[model samples]
Target chain A: MKKLLKYDYQYLKRTSKFIIFPVVIIILAVLSPLTARYLNEILAFSLGDQAGMFNFPDPVVFDSYVEYLSNLSDIYLYVIIFIGVGTFINDKTKGLYPLILSKPINRVKYLLSKYMTLSSLIFVSLMVGMLVFSFYTYYIFGEVDLLNVFLLSLLYFIYVELILAIAMFSAMYFKSYITAVMITFAGYILVSLINVFSFEFLKYMPGMISSNIIQVISNSASTPDVIYNVVVTLVITGLLVVLSITKFKKYDLN
Target chain B: MDAIKTVNLSKSYNNTLVLKQLNLNVKKGEVYGFIGKNGAGKTTTINLILSLILKDSGQVFINEEEIKFSDLAFKKLIGYVPDVPVFPSYMCAKDYLRFTLDIFDLGDSMVNQKTEEILEFVSLPNSTKKISSYSRGMKQRLAIAQALIHDPEIIIMDEPTSALDPIGRNDVMNIIYKLRGSKTIFYSTHILDDVERVCDRIGLLDDGNLIVQDTVDNIQKNFFSNKFYIETKNEPKFVLKKIAKINQVQNAVKENHGIVCYLEENTDENTLLKKLMEMDENIVEFRRVKTSLEDVFIRLTNEKTT
Candidate 1:
């Protein structure tokens, strides 16, 4: 495990992915809330008093949190997916796998190292972006609840883990990063299409978890609702990991 | 005990057989050269030995211990360098070596010491530049350093020098020569001249099986010929006629830049030389034609395919 860590840490140190992830997320983090707080000014600046064309609600602190979560779900999710897809595909294409597989490491240990490294980097990047946003959120709007923010961050972490697993699984399956990204997003679109039906099944889709999490943050959804979302996401993630490992073990590598 | 052995190993891809009941043996501390053409399953066999890919059947043993995919003990005994070794390209030479050394769990003291010795041994330049900036020859040298960092007993290399320029090829060959008795190397290549220069024994793989494995001398002797090669400034038609009339000479013909004379059974060199002197031809060079591994390789492979 330590050796795997050394290998991955060297990769993380040099990769532009780590740098890009945090910068993009930080921008989104600050922009979401700022956009929420100053929607009136932004509209008036661009449209004059004619911006009264739309029925805009008064800006509130809750509006900042809600808009931030919405931006995270809408835009930041695909960034995570694209980064996740490149993890294994690079190994295959670069002819590095034969050298690594030739070493004394087992398949499970190797795959685990890759998984942990990619996931942890994404996790750290998300936390750093959120921390920066928290400071700005407080500066702009008196004081936001730390406890509520912590719960929301935890929920977001769980959701990231799920999508990352999906992206990685697709990467392994297709053996191409671009194809993996396309398939992962395609899977997203397919599930979202299924989600549009008027049924009790809406809560089961992976995207619905974000809404449930935000509702939990806003004190509208029960803790049990959050648990249901967590349980389902974790279950799906567990299955994706198992599938990846099994397929990776059988991979020809050469 | 043999350093490496494979028994009836077989492999196929998508139902097309690539390796068929192949067997090989290399005694401890011997340089075993694996020679085969492209599409003759050289890389496939190497991959199976390292357990990079599963074999369809049969077993592999290193230093008498059988190999298993889950067991890393055998892996600890082996280091591999591919035809075109790929590095992180973002790391300097020292950083990349440090990563490989960490995998062996060596103490910091040993790591630092081996890093210096191995780098110096391969003769790579000490530099802070990233591997991405290194040329192909430089990368191959670093590949050797990484493979030897663990001090493994067996080193498997696939065409280590085939892609290098003459100077780089010489550098790689010199490194292999220096490691001769200390390490057992299973070198795979199609370059016969390299095998002639470095290998202690050779294996010829043709159509999914090992057609031959023996000492370099033995393979040459098995395919021995009585043909003699002569290169002279003398006229070719005159030399061919003068050589054809000798009682012991079977056939003589003009070759590119030389002449070939086949001696009759039990013919000796002195009797032929006397006739050559009597003919008074200007003999610039003369020697019994040596049967090269390349000849044996072509004959054996052609025979199998036909």
Candidate 2:
């Protein structure tokens, strides 16, 4: 297990993807609220004093965080996909698979170490990014709703885990990182975009749960909707993990 | 008991067969050299023994235990070094060795002690560069270190010197010498000279068959020609043909510049010379030479030997 973890750490540290992940998020976190606060000024710089033609209400810290979190669809999703798809597939290309699997250890244990290490890194980045974002948001626009933030963060965590599971399984099964990312992206878009704000029946989806996160942070989401989404996310992630392990057992891994 | 044995082991890819009923034995405390051309099922056979690939038919035994391919428990009995080894690019040599020891479940003190010993054995005890920055030779040495970390009974190497430069090859050859009699090494390579330099017994794998297997000296004696090279003023073909009719003479062949007469084991050279003198008066020179392993390999793989 110790050797496995050491390898896992090596994977997470490779290519400095972890650094890139948090750096991008940190930059986005600070920029989101800054954009919200200086919307008129930013617009004025672009439009050359034509900004005076339009007026709006003052920016709120909560709205800025919402926008920051909303970027989950574009920035965070892409970064995490980059992280997920290459963990194992790239090693296959570089001729490390045979050396590793040739050992006496079980392949599942090795795969789990990769999975857990990546998950932990992603978790740490998200938590640390949230902390920094919270501090900035509070300082710039007074205090944030700590309880609401906690609840919404939980929902987003499940949502991310679901995406991560898809990304990882696709990489393992397809054996191509690019194809894995493409498939995971296609799945994410299909699930997250279909009747996004208008669908009531399919709100139990992991994607739908993420979309409903605004309501959760705003303290307006119903308890049952939250419960159903969380349950479904866990179930889907669980199923994907089991499927991965099953395929791994018989995988040629050549 | 033999340290390694395979009974009628065979494998195929798609509809094409690669290894066909390969029965091999490697005794303990000896270096068994496995020689074959590229794509001659050397790697495939090694893969089967390591249980990295499932075989179509046959059984593999390590230290007399039947191998269960689906489970990797059998791997505990062997250590393997691939032709080109790679490691976690993020780690330096010391850390990588430590990690290897950990994988084999060594305790902390043992890990440290073994790591130090293995690194020292590989002559890279203080290398601080990440594996990614290492040269091919360095990686190969580190590979040797990692393979020895587990102290396995059988050490399987696939062309350990095939990919190294002259200096690197010498380094690895020296390492093999150091391991002589200390471990049972089943090494595969196309470098016949390396085999001759270190291996005690050799198994020639040709077209997936154990074409020839024996001790070095025995194989040479069994497959190679023990022929006298004779030069004469006139054409020696007629005299060689006469010599070929003798009961003690195995066969005779005409070379470009001389006649080569294969003699039976008990036939004396002076006796053959006297018989040749009686057959031909123009004999000018007579000599005998021992054939090399390369000649034997070529003869065994390409044609039936006398």
Residue-level error in angstroms, candidate 1, position A196:
2.3
Task: List the candidate 1 regions with Cα displacement exceeding 4 Å.
Answer: A191-194, B230-252, B255-258, B262-287
Q: Write the per-residue lDDT of candidate 2 for residues B176-234, one digit (tens) a residue.
A: 88999999999999999899999999999988888988988888766655668887777
All models: lDDT? 0.82, 0.79
Model 2 DockQ (Cα-based): 0.55
TM-score value, chain A, candidate 2: 0.90
CA-based DockQ, model 1:
0.65
Docking quality class, candidate 2: medium
TM-score of 1: 0.91
**Candidate 1's residue-wise lDDT over B1-306, tens digit each?**
798999999999999999999899888888999999988898999999888888899998889888875567788788898999998778889887888777767647777678888889999877788998988888889999989999999889999988899999999999999989999999999889999999999998887889899999998876646678877678777788778889898778898777898787587777887788888877888888887888778867876778
Q: After superposition, how far is residue A198 of candidate 1 from its true place, in Å?
A: 4.1
Query: Residue B122 of model 2: what lDDT?
Result: 84
Candidate 2 interface RMSD after superposing interface residues:
2.1
